[model samples]
Target: MMFTISVPKPGLVRFSHDRTRCLQKFDRTNSVWSMKMEPKFSHNRKIEELSVELPAQPHPPHLESSRDRALQFNRGQPSDKDLDPDDVFEFGGYVAREAMCDEEYWTAAFLRAETHWEDRNRDRYVESHLRKYTDQEFNEIKKRRNVQFGNKCRCIVAMKKDSKDVKRPVLKSMVGTLDLRTRHLVGGETFPEERVKPSNFGSFRMTRSNRYGYIANLCVSKPARRQGVATNMLHFAIKQAKLDELERVYVHVERKNKTAQDLYKKMGFQMIERATPQLEEKQLYLLCLEI
Candidate 1:
């Protein structure tokens, strides 16, 4: 004899064999369905059983936060009400936003290290006769440096929009970053051209009365270079400076970096001072923009 089983509804099953029928209720405790049947014409008995297991459902995707959506879709200039300390700007498929959490700080530190890895190597060789620290030690130092520097400045990071991949983290999409901080000029005047030291090339003595915005460590990942990521970041940083009520914004660039100089010039930056002949090897130039 052949038995047929059918499920008319959840938690219920029907079985039939040659004019004999039986209804079986699924046992939730054991997650199984069992049916027992007795034939009318024979003293022999037969039982048919089958085990059923339901597959586990997957968890739902994470929902994007309102701030994250704003950062991805907001294109127009931000209004005064939108100018928070952690303002975010989006342009074309990229976003420039203030780095807030530890992860973001770490990512920004990594970017800085990548951009100046060659310099680090050269410095190590020059200072320690090529003695090198292990990767773990170097990373730990970078983390400590990030915390120290982050306490003194605001960090802005540029990244591609990952709306399509909400599962991807921010660090994976980061493309560029820059640092903005308030600086004070000694005696409320710019440093003399000949006296500007490499150690304090664009930096001045700290004073509340002569506060100005300083931009430093503007760099884009190699694959994301020449794609306006740096430009957008600069604009965002300048906007932040304006929001902070800074009267002037300054950036120091190597004199040999014509590309950077040209980019800054296009953004209304004017060279205010050049390094002295004694410091020509450093090739640093101070550029300023009046806000």
Candidate 2:
């Protein structure tokens, strides 16, 4: 004899030949299954046959839309869809955002202090021995940063997002920082009064109104160096400067710092003013980028 069974939905169904047993296991959550059957006979005669029909399988979970995949991939963490597109920039698993809250300000201050501590110290031997700053020193830096921020200086921080922390998903830690501020430029002709023979020089005065953006205190964490964080921060600053209606952006770099000079040059910054040797012991070169 032969028996046939049909299932309306996708599930597991079992059958036995000797006792004509029909066992049905239904699970709404599961859409796939595997089956195994073994027949038994008492008298070594003709064995009974049984057949079962199962519904078609559902679509695979991996074959989802790109948006769905992104949502699923960033389930608990903050995503670009949740942020203001104008304020945040995403690149290379990092986000560059404006420093707003107290935690971000403190982090930016700590980054600046930690990276530029050696430059502040005059004595190289003493600097080499110092590993970190005291709490008072950090607080002082933070205070100075607060004053600058109050004075129209904008600070951008490159943050590495941590998806593991559901409480704080956006800014886990700061990798780099850059500050932008408006600066006034005055340009004209000046003649020395100590000229031995002052000829009939044409009295021509050239004065133009020039206001531009200035970038300063750009630094990245030691561990995050050489990973394009600095480049990304500079790009963000340029975009911000354009939004502020500034036509030119300038940066002052140490004369001996070839690495920084090369980076600025690569980003289309030209040396506008070379440091004068007679003026100061520590000289800096001024570079400008016309946005």
Candidate 3:
């Protein structure tokens, strides 16, 4: 038998008449080809197969960004779609929302300030303040029918979370607290204008009439102090004031506590020394910030 060979066209492939034979692979330049004989494939042979299809959906840009942020923050933990940055403010320690009836906010409020009172040697002053928080007195106070109007104390609380990886058991407790109330919400006499520094009272545009909110009881635990916790709380308060459409926030700082006064000053707060006619007239300062 003789065989004839010629160049194959682009669409044409040569085939041999012999059965049970197949062309495996071929290189044009070398004309090298290799093949291995195996059982032939029948036209009706059954075979297994697999395939997958994914459905696509369009997502808003903000939703994508929010999901990414949530994934990063939760770090493989479960999270809800409703979590928002504005709802929970945190820095060194987490600052939860306004206080509720759940935890002992009132008790922690007194305990946190005990150290300050002792350091100032104001034991008498501490006793005077404790008179209101007495067990019997607080019990009677809580039973009042008009408890809502009983006193104006708004506390924004901060808490430090316990670490899971620590070898020893950790205690999660209140680490910081702040109190605020609009001047109109509670009646009080503000310091005289002559005592306030003019430079510290820069003006901010007010959507509504200008009002001031009293910021009191701002404190952080010793361990959380000097971290960004205090700063975060102060800034968070200012942001809340802006949301309330208030023009300013006012706080009173004792003259003896120069450290806190300095911290306020660094946050752009102006001072107004008490002008009362007494030996301790200058014992306290009124710090004000224009939101």
Best by TM-score: 1
lDDT of 1 at 246: 69
Which candidate, 1 or 2, has the higher lDDT?
1
Give me candidate 2's TM-score against the actual structure.
Answer: 0.54
Candidate 1's residue-wise lDDT over 122-231, tens digit each? 46453233212222322443343331211235678886666633533545667777777654443324632234334333223233335677777677776676678888
Q: In candidate 2, what residue range of length 10 has the lowest lDDT sum?
A: 47-56
At residue 119, candidate 1 shows an lDDT of 42
Candidate 3 matches the true fold with a TM-score of 0.50
lDDT of 3 by residue, 240-288 (tens): 6776556877776666767777788899999754445421453566678
Each candidate's number of clashing pairs is 0, 0, 0
Candidates' lDDT values, in order?
Answer: 0.53, 0.51, 0.44
Q: How good is model 1 by TM-score?
A: 0.55
Would you estimate the TM-scores of all the predictions?
0.55, 0.54, 0.50
Model 3 RMSD, rounded to 1 decimal: 33.8
Q: Pick out the ten consecutive residues of candidate 1 with the lowest summed lDDT.
A: 47-56
Residue 7 in model 1: lDDT: 16
User: Model 3: residues >4 Å from true position, as ranges?
Assistant: 1-84, 116-153, 162-171, 185-210, 273-282
Q: By descending TM-score, how would the candidates be arranged? A: 1, 2, 3
